[model samples]
Target: MALLARRAARRSAASTKAAAPPAAVAVELSIPAHFRCPISLDLMRDPVTAPTGITYDRESIEAWLDTGRAAVCPVTHAPLRHEDLVPNHAIRRVIQDWCVANRSRGVERIPTPKIPLTPVQASELLFDLAESRDTAAAIARVRALARDSERNRRCLVSVGAGRVLASALASLAADGETPAAALEDVLAALVCMTPLDDEAARILATPTSLGSLVAIAENGSLAGRLNAVLVIKEIVSCIQLTGNVVEELVDALAKVIKAPICPQATKAAMVATYHLASSSERAAAHAAGAGLVPVLVESLVGADKSAAEKALAVLDAVLASEEGRTSARAHALTVPVLVKKMFRVSDLATELAVSAMWRLGRGAKESEEGEATKCLVEALRVGAFQKLLLLLQVGCRDATKEKTTELLKMLNKHKGVGECVDAMDFRGINRLS
Candidate 1:
């Protein structure tokens, strides 16, 4: 009995302690005003002085410059004469020292920031990398330079390193003895050169370089494939592609989309396809025949609004051809997916979806009345008629409404669609009747 009483007392005390609220720690740590960045209002990691003589975090200031959001300093509001940003090494050291001194307050010491390479320095590095006997080391150095800072990346492009990187990739492809690591680095460098200028893009658009990129897209690692796609996208966007180049891009992008290594890479591949397909009708037919319909349908089913919009646009372009229409009709989910997206995504997406349906329906109408009637019945069975009528009632673009009217009239002409039409409460149907 005595032991039992003691055990019960201990349990009650333990329960009380466990249920009690935790006490707040009262350590107050204040950051010195000089240590904070004027823009971010946080301790600076890499302080840099702009032309306005105001010190700000390097990333914040660079972002401001890159975005063209402001031509003046955030702190002084003085117009900048030039966009020169010099590193404030002295302030950085002071901030690091303060962090170290306040270590007990959970402060972390900031590492020394790497100095961004100048245009001349970047050119020299690229030259050495291209001429290096040690290919592996050269590749590693190139990747490190790319990962260093955005400023360095800009420097590389300013000094023509983009062309050098393209040449290296082309040479490697020609050698056929290039290591995977080296190839990946070259691809990464090219991608890092964002918004490639016309000169750099033309350099990468060469046949040998493009073939290498296609090879990488087809068989490289996930990162390599994504980089290749991104580089191709930039190249195609900046330069006018020739007939052969468009064919090559279509083939590579089609393969990448079929087994997309990643979601982002798939989106890149799709955008590239859209760019190429917009160039010619023959390219659209080629992309459609290369198994793009099913992939696009799959993407629409799972994509977010932006991705779905792009996918619909591509579908709209490609569906203009008979081969594209046939491929879309052959895909089991295409019609249902289009109907589902009619009013669910964006206005642009809606327009594109309705247009694709109009094209497909028109194609069916051209293939004998019986075949057209059968296709109309199938569309009605998938709730397409209800969605189209609702689209008309809710208001769409004038062009889209017109297309919707045509599609609805075509469907209502089918004798079997009477039941599908009656199921809708949309008053817009009276016009069709």
Candidate 2:
């Protein structure tokens, strides 16, 4: 209310101000002592001529009208107003001269500053020594880079020469001669490993390398968990290597999911498991044996929105698998949660929820016994159809045209969709009853 009143007052005052004729030529005016307001310390807005043949600003005049004694200056607390500011022309000239002196464009405006070394560049220095022909020189450089913190130096060296060393060691493994430096090279790389997919897979394949990577993951480093995900994508069948890698991956993922620092890594692990299950029979059995699906379902119903999203994504991936479609037959309660989340989640999550629900609905339709079909239909009616048509008229303008069209068709085929569809017609508009 106060804000509205002030705006009204300003507009009223501005309308009454008289306009002056345009100047025939450009004329510069120096700031005058009488033109400045003592209260605001700014050029006065509506100056009035005084009886003493001098012009005084509004604030100075206001102070004099309030009291007959000396008025305090607004800018400086010194006592001086109408009486002290006696139309001084000399002070105005000094201010204009000072302004003119400060006006210029020159070399003093350069803004460049001294640059410092980046950690990446420092890491590069360590790797450069690996290419040197002299072994002693290269090892000396590695030692210097490692310094007192062997982990830090190893991290740099692993990222740099780590791959070349690992490949060389892999070649030596075929010949049955494991050099002492081979394990160290792989360990160094694993400890310093970035979140790259290829490096992670290589590190996990070696038993010694896997132990080192696991240590990093358990130490709250996240590198081990990251490596586990890398290996998951490449496992084709249930060989000796596949079983060991899967066990390690599951163990590493369980540890990661429990940590507060990288729940996303846990999500990644679940997603990789989902993807693997879809492609391999052995993987499906392994994942189910590890109790992955129930854990993922719990996360979907969990409190955290981010974790729920990841869980849902994993579920979505899992549903695409033959095992997932088969498992959905037994879990009747899952459909309701997926339906409820469609509207409750973020925009992307909403789309994912819709997609997952649609797939499950279609999959259930194919079943002869209509497994979970009634519950899914009820969830869609209460969860999606209740609010979805209304949303089509509000935001979400860019929803995929075909998807939206398909949903509309499905809604029309639904039992209670008549009420929602009637709400959009001309006569029924705004009259939901």
Candidate 3:
């Protein structure tokens, strides 16, 4: 009886081991070979066929091309003649069917991939939109197209659709017509024109077109405002602005930043401000006067690293002129905010913050009993001297250290606060002494 029980136990143990391999095998069998991308070795979400007769995910293949690797088929190693990647619809349908059949196994259906817009199709769509009397339908269609794949966006730009849309916007503005729906659609399409070419940017930068965008920024829907700001940022990056245009741009950016729109729009506004201010001191002063300094100081209250860095950079640019320095000094939180950011953010932010402080300090020393002295007093009250001592002791970039040394000397001269520096117990202060 004991021998029989041991034999039965051995048989059960062998049977349990045999059952374990089938679960993994079943999982392996569920994924069809054709569904996998050769490049990524995963189930393709958006498969396209290369000219070499092998299918791959569109994004994966685009990244492959972007890397400038050998122009050979990854699978068959055949020399690729052309880079055209056609959608493999048959395989996609098969994969969908397989997913449906496996629904009981918790397999989710892959969404149908959006068809990319071709240049011809984009041109025709632009013409239809231009002539369409149904404004709502046109807006919906434009939004859908803009939200589609990246390839469609590139095609829209290549087919001159962006220029046509800008011209339409210009005409609308010239006639003093502001159909909210149509304007939103046009602005959204312009945003989709990533890498807006010089000509497209020039068209959008015109006074009429730019004013339309500003109007959208002021009164359009949140989506419209976000897209407008983004398009403006892209346009500013590609072109140079001067005189009234720069002033208008800065004003629009300030309004958007002050509004309760989305974070993306705010970030876009901040970036646009930085770009415009960096272009020239005139633009920087204009931006500062447009309530940019106070807005940036408030933005730093709870800003992330990237946003804080950008804000500091814009502040630095704005502080280059006497007017900009005056504007910054007038803001109650300017010195404390910059002092707070000195070492708390990135090294780049530290450098920019230090430079801005140096400028403000230099301006204060040159003053008799004016706003500059007030700014200096504000700095001291905010513990700017103590923070500067700590920054020197903790050690920073070489340039930052040098600027900190200069700022300390200037502050010491004004306040005669040599005891403040003497009270700090940092090693770097000893080096400074």
lDDT of each: 0.78, 0.48, 0.76
Better model by lDDT: candidate 1 vs candidate 3: 1
The local lDDT score (0 to 100) that residue 49 gets in candidate 1 is 89
| Per-residue lDDT over 171-260 for candidate 3, one digit per residue giving the tens place of the 0 to 100 score | 666767667667777777667666667777887777887888887887788898898888888889888887787888888888988774
Candidate 3: pairs in clash:
none
- Relative to the true structure, candidate 1 reaches a TM of 0.81
| Segments of candidate 3 deviating more than 4 angstroms | 1-30, 67-71, 76-83, 111-114, 126-143, 279-282, 330-332, 364-405, 408-433
Ranking by lDDT: 1, 3, 2
Top model by lDDT, which number?
1
**In model 1, which runs have C-alpha deviations exceeding 4 angstroms?**
1-28, 51-53, 81-83, 127-139, 174-181, 239-248, 368-372, 389-402, 415-433
What is candidate 2's CA lDDT for residue 172? 39
- Compared with the true structure, model 2 gives a TM-score of 0.46
Best by TM-score: 1
C-alpha RMSD values across all candidates: 7.0, 20.9, 7.6
lDDT of 2 by residue, 146-257 (tens): 5534334434554454454344334434444455344344333433333334553463357654444344445523443454344333331222245565555545554555
**TM-score, ranked from best to worst:** 1, 3, 2
Error of 2 at 26 (Å): 50
Total clashing pairs for each candidate? 0, 0, 0
